[model samples]
Target chain A: MTDESMTNGTMTKSQRIGEIVETSTTGFVAVSKTLHQPPALGSLVKVQLGGEDYAYGVVAFGTTVSPDPGRRAVPRASDEVYDEAVYARQPQLTRVLHTEFSVVLVGCFEDGSIRQHLPPHPPRLHYDVHECTSDEVRRFSERLVYFRLLLDAQGQVPAEQLLAAHIRQVYRARGHDAAWLERAARQVTSLLRDDYDRMMTVLYGIEP
Target chain B: MARKRLGVVTDGAFNAGLTVRLDPGVSTEEMRIGEFVVVEGEGNRYFSLISDMQLRATDAALLADPPREASPFIAQALRGTTTYATVQVKPMLMMPRGADTDFLVDLEPPQPVRTIPMHFAELHEATESDFGAVFGHEDRTHFAMGKPLTMDIPICINLARLVERSNGVFGQSGTGKSFLVRLLLCGVIESGLAVNLVFDMHDEYAFGKESEDGVFVKGLKHLFGSKLLVYSLDEKAQARGGRGVDVTLQIGLNQIEAEDVLLLAEELNLRATAEANVGLLTDAYGADWLSRFLAMSPTDISAFCEQYGAHEGSLSALQRNLKRIERRPYVVPEAPFSVIDEMVAALDKGQHVILHFGRYDHPLDHMLVANVVTRRVRHLYREKVERYEQTQSPADKPRPLMITIEEAHKFLNPAVSRQTIFGVIARELRKYHVTLTVVDQRPSGIDSEVLSQLGTRITGKLTDERDIEAVLTGVSGRSFLRGTLESLDTREQVLLMGHAVPMPIVVQTRKYDEVFYAALGAGEKRSAQLDIVELFGE
Candidate 1:
């Protein structure tokens, strides 16, 4: 698919996954349109800020909670009613329990090439988050500098597991580029020098 | 193979040498001690030797708990980054980088390392040109001794510098010390830099002898023919169908001096009083003392001792020791027409002489004969040198002479080095146009003063620490070279150091097989034609 948007400067509606609910320089929280589902953990997602400028992030954490902080949802499913069937039974439950995921700002695509660093500005609130195309994932993973940001990200999910899952996703997106996998592993190894235990943990977690 | 980048200089000192951290791709297993290396600094290139190596890790815990055997990826990633190898390179010499051309290099020779390469200088496996530039190429004055330990390039030694002073060849028995000495003799003969007087104790250098591999290796006589002369001390053995002998060496009893007997005090089991009695006997009987003392009965010795104011017991013991020299077949009361004069005349005419001991290979026999012959030759050389100084005529000048002696410690130990002719030649350098090539297994037994005066020392593997220390006496940067010397291969490898080489190096000695025979035989033919032209005045 073409990286450039139509004349409207917006991604197609089918490609949209969520809208930015809260924004910060380092990260943002996006609420998914589907109930109890945010983008798969560590998957690449992007938000466009008009024209060809876009901000990128890796899905760091996900949770489904009540819309209000004070509100608590009561147990309503029985032995026969669970999973999708229970969700189908309670139509209003989907609206009350919103699914939101946190995204750590990795880099941005501005001017012409992908910059493997934090965006110049935080993406505006309420902007649509889109699932990047296979070509974008291949292009972005080419420069692995952003690996440091993911490794240093502070979140409930351990950094090693988060980076490993993201690499697995990118590996598949890039049609199983084995050479790139080794380069990515070596890059992480160099950054974690002297931290032998942590380096091994990441290396073992990312084994193809 | 192409020259490979091995590592980078990370840490070191001028005295201790530089520490090089291996590059991410280079393997530690491939680095060998005594191998040559070059460090490319900002403006200079330092030629060095790999003296030591160590394996290091970024974290101690990584060594304690290495990656599991099943996980190759963790091991591979940790190899060049977290855990790596470092080699200790002893920088021997340094030269500026722009002196790449041969003409420029000759103009600016490498100097002893006074400073270390800067931190992080690139290190590489030494190339052939590096060996050529440092050790020089084979020519009239330089002889290709051997190749460096890990390279195919020949490492040359300056024959002119080698013959300028006394030299040594040392190693334990069967470590190829004799083979190395033979190669050196061939080089000296081929270069025609100096004439040689070899005391061949085992009869190996004169006539071809069977090697350990059952192959008959050719000797100097076979290669040089008429240009070399073989003198046999055992006429009977020479008569038993062997290579032709030019002369039968016979030492008249009257020719044996008191100094020659005193030099063999230990070999003949003489006491302190023997020295004083020998002096009295020499003062009384002059040059005929050895024969007269041997002819005396116990009563006659007592009468002579009483009249000469010498102890009768010392004189009796001296007579007993004198008997051992008289029993040798070559020793006689008189005749044989001044054999010393003949050998000296041969040496003066630019012919190499090898005095094969034949059956008298015992240390006592070798010691007595070598000392007697060398003393007389040394005296003749001294007179010739004095005559040349007085007359200032080219005809009176003495030709340069190199005396090669095996079991050198017997004549050069602390007790006799001050009086033996070999020790005197060693200390005098080339003053009387005389030098010595001492070959021995127990260099430790050699006097420290004499050992220090050695110009070039080619040593094979030595197991004795004291012998090693003695060989390296008075040498600079000896501690670093000790490791290289100790790491030498047991056969055909030697550590060449001192005046003859620009820097200390370990080399795989050239083989003394048919290939060497071919090289020497060719040189002999050229010299032979020149000799014929000179004789005919064409």
Candidate 2:
């Protein structure tokens, strides 16, 4: 899912996740309040940029941690037996722990045309990020060529798993067209006929 | 006028051929094995045959090392990322047009894989005009044989290579070897460039036969009409009911020479002394030897042998071997007229002949007549060729003849190759404007040298590794075509390669129907199409 096609005025205030904290040629780091759930892993997200355009990336990972690891402290009250009860007593833990997610830049979309490459410039710091809407993901998948760029992405991430998850998310985003899935499978088969084992493994992973 | 790019040359050093990687979004189904493709390099178009294909993902090696068990979600995302089709091509020749004229007039020498540039130059699926330009669409050297497996265009082969050298058709039984040979003969005859002498062992070529499916198949005589004549030896009664038989062919015993007798040495099991004695008897009794010599009783033979200074065992063995010939109903002391002479005359006037074996389909009878007749035809063609070379006159030129030998291995086997007339023709008859199309199931049985000499080979499905190896002997890129050869459907799918075709191609052999006959313009309508007298207002 991607919100590249969604308008700025239409996005509800509640959809705001956080601000872009750091950026690089490959991806960006985002910091948000612990309140909102991290966008589903492998889901497309749009980071607001210096320009009017949105920089797109797949949510590779998400985590929450204390602001200062050196100043860590944990105290289990004698009467408290669960983390929920302990968190209810120590409300300041919310202020200490912050949610942050990292995303690999897959492509950029402006005027509803998807460009599967690094954006001309990184999104300006502190810009808000939003989960991609289903409409946006559907619009991006009409050609399915961006799948090439995503597959070609360089990272330590499990490419096969990431690819499968992204496809599953997009497949649902596009109304679960079995025909499209089969066509995609044919392409994969053509490329990997010799590696019968891997083809099978990859194909098995594609099944929902 | 830009043509579509089939693919681009991928990175690989080519010694005899090169591989091309399909571009993004290019489907693998668009091309087929054995179809012709061209590579653009250094301002020239280089032609090649699609030998094989290899398809695999780019990270196949990585995938091999304990792939992370990912769900279908991962598979969907990874689609088309590194997967691609690689087309392995065997380069044949380049068609070079003059830089100034932009017209390709001269044929480039067929030199393969000398220099393959690494520029990843674009390649294109060979068009109909491209195939026509290389294989020819002209009246002199063209005859449509079949259509390309992928395209709707008809395939034509070079007639010069076909008539200038011998050819072979090989396949397992019921693979339509006869149908393929019939189609090939039609092409040869339709061109009016060569005459055919088919030794029809099954009696099918003279008259149509009810196929295994009960469909009546038309023989060559039915298609070519008066141009084709059927000469039956022992099949006179049944062949007469059919329309094609022109002569009740009868071979005189005098026509069987020493060499003719030697062709049946395996069947007759002639010993060295007996075989030598048969020649001696021919020399003494002369041309009438077989009739008079075989008629001699044991008492007369012993007395004659003592007078003629011959060994009893040798003469007796010769007499015993001659007994088989006496039993054949077609053999006579002397026929009213010689069938060999009649055949030579008809061929001289550019008519084709099919010798239907009929009930005489036994190896002995078929070999004897075919051997005797073809030996005479070879001598006749040699003298004509000699005369034409000396006189330099059009009338002295001999009409090219192609002898079609069915069940070719039975006569051109390794043991008989050194002695048989068919073997001699396969070796040296091309110079005399005579060639042979040896059709057989067991290519492994044919002599290796004879097999190599065959200028073209049209092969159907063959499962035997030895037979496949024999068929692919001396064939370039044979390793690459193994799958296509072994996997061909058992019917009309045939892989035609060697000199006749521009490159190796697996064709869905053309159907023999009205459209095919009409394509030949009902046998050379070129001369009748125009008259110079009318142009002169005469």
Candidate 3:
């Protein structure tokens, strides 16, 4: 259950959609789908920061609708809007994944564009958006593959592989050029490896 | 022919019949009662009396048979009128072994048929000389009778006699008192009729060691071998320290009466108000009052008493009394503390038990041992009586348990004793088949009432006048011989004569070998010296 509803406070976009995933000080992926925005909330998004690929996260919360005429008009969908047509197109989708993913809230700029808040060190890093049919998201969430892997591995991922995958996926999905992706990946790989290695070792012991 | 003398048989064995011809020279007055007479055809010489005489006319027809042989001379003797004189013929006239005595009387005589008074006479003489010769034989010897008569004659009559009644052995020191006691106990055990318990005070009765002959020697050996359970108060005291305390002090004071406290105070001579306050406290707070009193500071309970002017000293005295009472020691037999209950259980199962308290210290230790034993015996008897009454069956024969208390005077003290365990035994043990065999040197020191209750008294020689007097008074008159009372030497005892002995007799006590008697007074002085040495040595 969302903290807003539990504590009798005004509902946030993520809380209106589903439960909130509270995070510790450590970085974690946010669910960004089934939230305030329709296609964006329902989409699978890859965030490449410091040349490291984080596992898929759904659109958790949509940006507030802007009154400015230059901003693109995003679909104004309630909880019932995705009932038949969206679900019929995604047969493998289940309600638990929608509920789990829908609680995440993504940041937005005042101009009503998605914010570019990637880690500054890897300047060429980009966001990759995959229009995850409800089936894919449901299958991913249901498998809890990455969560199980993180738990089994005690919360550590290989730095070089993660950075390479992140850059490649972001470039492919956002139609970014391979040259910039390769250069960014190359530069950040070594540094990310060291940083990730040190951070993971300190946070979770080296055995994991 | 002369008138014939008549003859009649007297004793059956003297079967000879005598026909004494009436001769004028003889007279009938010389005949006697026990004279032997002889007659023809009788086997032996017979003595006769002229029982009856009659004169009748001659009947010629009755004389049918002719005389087998011609009759001998008719010798006539003068007798009174109607005289049919009896005369036993001489033994030479008999035919042989089987001849019968016969007498012939002639109706007509050559002189005249004159009647004379009848007389019976023996044909042969039996004189005083004959008697002396037959009965008196100089070579024979007479059997010797028992000892000379005395007041203890009755006691001797019952010597080695089984006494089912409880007996007590009492006397003063140097009286060979324990010797007498040991003799009585050995008698009872040897009789194989009764089981006995000896509350051995000095351990004198404890049996061990051997004789030269290797007779599995006696003393208390039988008791020890049997179900005897020895409870040594001295050992207990040593094991527990002199501070051996009875746990009964923990019994709730609520169960105790005000009178009990008063009696206890009176025994200890505590102040009256203290006793009263004890009762009051006991009544108010119950058993925990002592703990509560102890919890109070100043070690005094009077301050806590709401009553005004109930003296503090009395209260302090009461506190001291309470502490002493709490410290009174007890002997917990392998069985339960209730001796009578344990005894009854043992008795009901026909178990023989010996409670040996041989190693106890002097006085109070003796008292405690006596008390425990007597209490158990009395309890068993009472239980049996109750059971008999309830069942109304003849099957219940209340078998008595013999409880022997050595050094009895210490525990059975009459003048000053109050509510002691031994006192109960002394008073009520008889009804329960609990017979007390009190063995003590100072018989006078024991209570008169308790001494009176002892049925059989086996008194050894008593030197002390007072102890002898106590014993004399306790024993019945029949048992007290004049000289025996004043001066009975050692090892010589007048037995029975008390309530316990059915008969009074003086008996030479069977001597036990020196080893058994040596146990008494052996270590006492040496132990005292050793104790002193240890105390000074430290």
Candidate 4:
């Protein structure tokens, strides 16, 4: 193809991309090749931007449309259908993506194309990292957050996963900075070993 | 005219005597035990009865010259001189019966001694024999006798009369009121004239010295063989193999009318809608409804109400009311229903029923049971009395059902007059041969109206003047015994002042230590011991 034609096509593609981004940010999704539906806020989906795949993004807000028929509209699709596709992909991604993303959903473009958006900045992670000190503390806290989120998503998570994440976080944060790493390590190890103790204590027919 | 010489004895041995010439009007009967007399040669002297007659004369010359200057001839002459004179005697004076008399005598020359009469003083001396004869071994005889039915002091006269006539007891704490009641119970049981039903609050009267065996058990066992029915409202009974006697306790809400239930609900501070719903449920279910109501699952009852288009609030209210009723220990299933029914049945059979409510924690439960039982007995008694008044029968002389409530103030107090069954029994039971024997520490706490109706008053040694005053208001004030009531000590009770006993007399009461000792402290300790045994197997 001629450079001029290629540039024109690229501009058209860029314009289409701009419209998609604008509609997505406005909480709308394209339902068909040419039509759009008003977006439902809190809908989740995946979006591709700058050649990297972002697995989940939530529809944070929906913009009011002008009544004029000439104005191009954005699209919105149901979340139930989107969830099926999302679940079929890497199942572990459900945990990571659910905690990281505000919403997960699917959408169709005007040219019969599909697109996804997964917002990079998860609000919950931001809240946690805001109070973090050293990189080790931040990283450890992130792992702890990840395990907690996983447990929340699954209803019941393995005790080992919780203990491992907890110990790693503590070790990374306090190994060098702590005055007594060996003692702290021993205590943390003992605590991790008795991961199931508290739960058992609560449920072992001991009345509240 | 003649002068008569008379001799008066001073000492029993006649060691010294007085001789005097009588004034003619003096009589021998007029001569007093202690009087002054003078002989012709003797000086003035006092003499008293050694005997009625017999005198050893003293020398008048010795008195005249003070012995130091007396001539031997004059002294001999004074000793031997017995000059005769004309004698005179006065007419005998008459004295009234039961009256005391005093007299004075005077001796002088030429006539018999003159006598003067005076009024006599009355004296009362109580002896140990009197105390020993009335108090008995228990030291609670005065209480048992129910004598001295007065308000001034605690004497056994009123109590004995009260028990004999109306058959009731009253007092205040530390006033030996319970001790009096124990005495009264012994009296009633011993009299063989009437039967007793004791509502023993605090469970004091329930158990004897034998911890495991109690008066309640013994009485029940006597009435119902080895199977003494006991109903416990402890949660431990719900556990497997708990040590509680199994009996059916069906509480009939229908026994009380809707208005009455509402009134009770209002009094209890229950929700209006709940009260209304309970009233409706009770009306629908009738007397046996409580059984079905308790048997129904909570969810089922809720669903049933919903099916009938009842609001959730009303349904919830009904459930709450049921729960409130169920929460009472007495209302728990496996309670002694049959025992109560048997007691009622025994009343119908003209047999006496004694409910020994030994040391129980909830005095109100005793009151409640008293209320229910009294209500039922009163109803039956009314029917019988009415029937008898219409047509007299040999078997129908007021069935003679006596209800003896220990710690009566707890139930029949005017302050918390909740119209319990006991209140009805107290008010109306008397007319139908159902007499109430209200026993309590504080007689002042008992309702005056009920207290007044108790024709017989049994008063024991009451230290509280107020309680004594409360009791004394029920008796006649005309008797001389009223004045002496204050002098009465413990175990010396005034009896039969009320209509029951013909006369007020101090009588000794029989001892029933088994029943009395059981009524001492709160009965909860026994139940606690039983609880420990069941819970810890100790």
lDDT values, one for every candidate? 0.85, 0.75, 0.41, 0.39
Task: List candidate 2 segments past 4 Å from native.
Answer: A1-208, B1-8, B20-35, B38-44, B55-87, B95-113, B119-130, B138-140, B242-244, B307-309, B336-338, B518-538
DockQ of each: 0.58, 0.12, 0.00, 0.00
What value does DockQ give for candidate 2? 0.12
TM-score versus the correct structure, for each prediction:
0.92, 0.77, 0.39, 0.39
Model 4 C-alpha lDDT per residue in residues B38-155, reported as the tens digit of each score? 2222221111111122222233332333334434422222222221121111111112221111111121212212332221111111122222222222222233342122112223
lDDT of 4 at B465: 62
Residue range with the least summed lDDT across 10 consecutive positions in model 1 chain B: B99-108
Which candidate's DockQ is highest?
1
Tell me how candidate 2 scores on lDDT: 0.75
CA error at residue B41 for candidate 3, angstroms:
47
On lDDT, the candidate that comes out on top is: 1
TM match of model 4 to true structure: 0.39
> Per-residue lDDT of B164-264 in model 1, one digit per residue for the tens?
98999999888898889889999998888899999999888988888877888987888888778988888886686658788888888877778888877
Worst 10 contiguous positions by lDDT, candidate 2 chain B: B528-537
Q: Write the per-residue lDDT of candidate 4 for residues A1-208, one digit (tens) a residue.
A: 1223222233233211112312333222332112122223322233333232222232332333433436543332356546456546545443322111122222211122222222333222111111122332322232222222222221122433333333333445454433233332322322322233332221121111
How many clashes does each candidate structure show, in the order listed? 0, 18, 65, 75
What would the C-alpha RMSD of candidate 3 be, to one decimal place?
58.3
